[model samples]
Target: MIIQKEISLKPKSRGFHLITSEIYNHLPELKEIKTGIAHIFIKHTSASLTINENADPTVRSDMETYFNKLVPENATYFEHTLEGKDDMTSHIKNTIIGSSLIIPITNGKFNLGTWQGIYLCEHRNYGGTRKIIITILGER
Candidate 1:
């Protein structure tokens, strides 16, 4: 059986937001499932999904800084700027980070490596509410 779920999230900042726990907590109420796969997807053009280290806050901060440097907000060579200065940069970031992740599951639980976590990367320079799509596929 494949179960699909969607979650709405409000980010407090303009960067990566750890959301692994929330998705882990909302798996499902099914039984008889042994092996499965968890697919997480972010439904936004200006944002992305990243499965990375979530144990320390510094890692997240450093990632944000790195992306900013990779795609500077006020570069004088962008074309899509009707939204704001961060609009084009946000799109660039999203392209690099991607928008979905697939994780293996065993015994009805996600199979994540040590310190591995799921994050919603908000490239825009402001807080906003975004949608997360969670899908589980397995035997049941």
Candidate 2:
């Protein structure tokens, strides 16, 4: 069976947010698939999707800090400044983190580690609702 759906996430501030529950909550069809793969693709350039530590909020904070330092805004070399100071940096951060994720689904649930979860890396100061396309493929 193959299922495809587009989910819109709520607006979030600039930071790494755990969104594993939100994804599952929107996809009730996942329960029908005993073995499959969930391919989640973010439909934006300023944000990204990644799997990371879900157990601690500090991990998310540290991630934001690290990335901010890694890709500082208002740099003299940034040419894409029409949007805002964070425009170019957001793109860079998205590139580093990526825009998609593929995870195994076993026995109707995501095959994620105990401390792992899906993260919506919002790189802009006010990244509005993000859209994601979820494509599930496998056998029931």
> Model 2, residue 10: what's the lDDT?
98
Best by lDDT: 2
lDDT of 2 by residue, 74-131 (tens): 5789999788999999999999999999999999999999999999999999889999
Candidate 1, residue 15: Cα displacement in angstroms equals 1.3
RMSD of each: 1.6, 0.6
Q: Write down the lDDT of every candidate, Cα atoms only.
A: 0.83, 0.95
Every model's TM-score: 0.92, 0.98
**Candidate 1 residues 1-140, lDDT tens each?**
88888888866578887888777666654234688887888888899999989799898899999999999876899999999998988888989999999888877667788888888888887748888888888886
